[model samples]
Target: MPNVSKCQSLYSALVSRFQSENPSLVLSDTISSWLYQSIYSIYETSGEEEAERYVREAHMV
Candidate 1:
């Protein structure tokens, strides 16, 4: 699992990329909240190394 600080950084990067994909609008609050939860789920299920790799592979790291 990722530490809080690392998770925060990864979440920000993911959200940024998500928003960038739709320049005209951002994700809904509901979806954004889901994203935060979803990332943590990945970290929890996959462990630190794989989770970090998951984000890094997406250029989030």
Candidate 2:
């Protein structure tokens, strides 16, 4: 969303996965917002490596 190249795959995977999980949400934009919030929170509190780990673990779950 903000041209953070490293976040591209994380954003795509999160948007796709969350949309599939919560069909009732009905808005990709909402999911994108949530994803950005989650990722930025993790990035701020934990750092990029942890954020990437979050994305990888999300795929597992």
Best by lDDT: 2
Candidate 2: lDDT over CA atoms?
0.70
Per-residue lDDT tens digits for candidate 2, residues 16-39, read: 776687766554577668777787
Which pairs in model 2 have colliding backbones? none
lDDT of 1 at 30: 95
Candidate 1: tens digits of C-alpha lDDT, residues 14-55: 767756866665667897787667667778888667656765
TM-score leader: 1
State the lDDT at 23 in candidate 2: 64
Candidate 1 deviates by what RMSD?
4.1
Show pairs that collide, candidate 1: none
| Candidate 2 TM-score versus the reference | 0.57
Off by over 4 Å in 2: 1-3, 16-27, 59-61
Error of 2 at 22 (Å): 11
Give the runs in model 1 whose Cα sits over 4 Å from its true position. Answer: 56-61
